[model samples]
Target: MSFKGEQHPGVQAPTPDSQGFRLNHTMLRIKDPEKALAFYTRVFGMQVMRRLDFDEMGFSLYFLAKLDENEQVPEEQGERTVWTFRQRGLLELTHNWGTETQADFAYHDGNAEPQGFGHICFSVPDLEAAEAWFDANEVEFVKRSDQGKMKDVVFVKDVDGYWIEVVQADRLSALGD
Candidate 1:
């Protein structure tokens, strides 16, 4: 539904046209799919659900869980694409046309002074275990739960320098601390 906090006076009671609206995916412009895909799938357990390439456009990739290799998937490409869009909690990473060749290409990770887009978050089943795993894997951290102003949250950075907030939804009480 709506984001946390009560809807403001002007935005209360969503309009009829927004009835079926859903956030299909939040996209990030990545410089290299190889590095980005490895981090997401290896670290977060996401799989490459679908790969869409526009003839005129550079990139359109959707990552999520797909049927196991032994399982049968839709034979038609169109059907596969539809399956990806219909699923919930999608994270799409797109690479520009020629960024692959540029060794120094990078995105303006939105955490800078003129911040607009903040970060995307993931909820783990166990907060303590997740933090340990991240530590073992050397995932860069913006702040750790123990040292931060907040008690039970972790902020990490992706290959593209985007901040990823990790949390345990069950421990809602620790957030305010």
Candidate 2:
């Protein structure tokens, strides 16, 4: 399928076994789960749907999502876990046992020398309101809506210094230009 104006010639329809495949989640290794979770939940209005602790592995996974209108998270652990796995656009934060106490611990945010993973984006209903919200919350701005050539899109950094792009998606058609 063609994406935006770029099409990979080698890309084609999924094979039978992959017919129903979907992007389930993207994982980001975090040094401190508490700060990361607070940033995502309080600033972006996301909620923790489920969490899995792998004590043997010395790491834990936290699944969070900004629910759609009228969407409800399952109250039971078994059902919540199943629902979480089935949903799309999940942000999974992986916390290793003791990274939080390490003074110099950091993760590659993928925007430096060997840029790989770029960023995650959030679509807001009102661009102006979102900007004000970010300002009120003292969120670090990588690029503010009015700062650059793009007029209505904004970018902010999380506690981990990961880029989170914010935009009024209704105006996204112009971005394709």
Q: Please state the error at residue 42 of candidate 1 in Å.
A: 0.4
What value of lDDT does candidate 2 attain over all alpha carbons?
A: 0.91
State the lDDT of candidate 2 residue by residue for 1-177, as single tens digits: 555354578866656997778999999899999999999999999999999999999999999999988998789999999999999999999999899999999999989769999999999999899888988999999998888888788989999989999988788786854
**What's the lDDT of the predicted structure labeled candidate 1?**
0.81
Instruction: For candidate 1, write residues 95-166 as lDDT tens digits.
Output: 776797898878899989798899999988898898888888889999887775777888999888999999
Candidate 1 residue spans exceeding 4 A from truth: 1-5, 65-75, 174-177
Candidate number achieving the greatest lDDT relative to the actual structure: 2
Off by over 4 Å in 2: 1-8
lDDT of each: 0.81, 0.91
Score residue 111 of candidate 1 by CA lDDT.
Answer: 85
TM-score of each model, paired residue for residue: 0.85, 0.92
- For model 2 the TM-score comes to 0.92
Model 2 has how many clashing residue pairs?
0
